[model samples]
Target chain A: MGWFSWGNKNQDISEPSRQNRQKCWETRDSYFDCLDRANIIKPGDEGNSCAKEKQLYEDNCAKSWITYFNQRRVLADAQKDRLAQAQAQADSARK
Target chain B: MREVSHFVTLMFSQRALASLARRTYVGGQQTARHGRRNFSQTLKRQSQFGKDRNTIGTLTPASAAVFVATGVGLYFYFRYEKQKLLEEREKERSSRQYGRPQIGGPFSLTRSTGETFTEKDLLGKWSLVYFGFTNCPDICPAELDKVGTILNKLEPALGKTFLPVFISVDPARDTPERVGRYLADFHPAFVGLVGTYEAIKGACKAYRVYFSTPPNADPQGDYLVDHSIFVYLMDPEGQFVEAFGQNTEADQIAARITEEVARYGK
Candidate 1:
């Protein structure tokens, strides 16, 4: 659900940590900036601006954004997996 | 509060034991330990502080250690319960959580129709709310895909009953038209929302969500937003019923949402 909904408190993405928050913010900004640059460079309202070519630019930007997030998502998943393994090891050691 | 009660119980029981010891020492039932009255008074003050949220009550060394662990356990338990309740409540905000209905604030947001949508509009309908920008690279699309999957799954059971909503965080570029086109890729059933920066900020604040621009090492750049990711379920009558996280399975989410619809008498 969006931020306004209930049941959101338990989300791992909702966890408050300086590093995670910073990383999210940083990555998002860099990606968006890339888009803005693309947005600016997109052929303007001039009659000669090619519609199909402008779409090509937009599509490329969208793909780049997807790639960045997918890489980040993979890293995040790996980190969680590593953490779970460490916790399991600790539990066994305690036992 | 629970912690304080447990401590008070421990202290009282310990006092009873001390009194018994004193009775044996003096060979009389009326006898008391030295400074017993003062110790009891101290505990009373401690409990009061706990009630005020100014201090946490402590127990004897061993008891405190065990109690501390339990307190930690309880904290996590309550957090988990609250999350579940939030999701359930959003599923039936006007209906109930794991418990009873709780009131949420009434707020106004403009939808893609260029019409101002308020909490009132959300009432009498189940809304699956998502937050992201049209420029979002990954999470937003993934989440929206999940939404599409969920809608496809639940449409037969909940046709025209549930509403999927997308609210844009990047107002700098995500106009109503942009959000509309973006959501169209996911589901025709999706409703797009975009408003002034202040308007979106107010809603986010009410929800205790954090979204901020990443500090840039460079000067000229359009920043991205870091926001909470969950699909909020707002029940008929505009109460937050439930929410799902980034990885919540689509079928599971649709099931819970459907269950809420039936259980809430809506």
Candidate 2:
């Protein structure tokens, strides 16, 4: 009787505009997941969709979506780098 | 240039000597009032000469008795002052030991019983708080089971009751009724808390718990929330004591909590 996970069942997809936004976000996630699965984007590497060589099917993705996803990814990657650097420092201090 | 250097040195020496003399005079005055004889030999000799006149002929019995009584009084006075200082130092050390992390604060939430609960309500009793959503597939239920079992075991042995609290991070889906139903399956004494997203977030921040909803989750697909899986032990004063990680066994957790509650009783 349950078609989906109860936690995700309440997502607002009634409005067409909201549906488009959700679709765009899902597509971006899929593109990133595909890149990750294909080994095109390695873990711990800075994901820069803005780079011409790094663009993941830019023609298929909307420009606004691409910009939004790239900005968020860059911020997350920067935070990861900081966390790694802090971990290294702590390791050295422990030694 | 040599004459100027000599002049500066001479002036500095003069000032230093003057300050030393002033300090000695002040110290001598205080020593005189206290009948102490350390400041200056000259002052000591003068005090001894004056006392000798008072006792020139023979030691009066009244004066001898007064002297002995004053000596006894001085001994007790110094002993009492030393004891007070030691007690103050011990107090400072214990306060530093109780320097528990600043966690737990005012947060308005709804309990499973359709009652409003706040951090103030947790004032008088020790609480075991865990932050996780009811939809958690495995870890949340397993952890809650461990907590319930530990609480049950500890109660009979220690004869003490502890508030077992479950605060949901997924407030949007976890209504008070949903939380109530979920907790009912765990422990009879267990309480479930839910609130608006902002209120729940505030509580999480106060407790240093972290949770995030997965991004771009399918509306019609299975999903999981990523969060910290630690059961926080809060003392009666609403202060964080320690936390038990997910991997900790129920027996070990019970032993640890028993030791903690015993220590808390003291």
**What DockQ class does candidate 2 belong to?**
incorrect
Worst 10 residues of 2 chain B by lDDT: B31-40
TM-score of chain B of each: 0.58, 0.62
The list of candidate 2 runs beyond 4 A from truth reads: A1-95, B1-98, B214-222
RMSD of 2: 16.1
Chain B TM-score in candidate 2, rounded to 2 decimals? 0.62
Estimate, for each residue in A20-81, the C-alpha lDDT of model 1 and write its tens digit.
Answer: 33344564455444544554322242233344443433333333343555466457667988
Against the true structure, what is each candidate's TM-score?
Answer: 0.51, 0.49
Q: Interface RMSD value for candidate 2, one decimal? A: 14.5
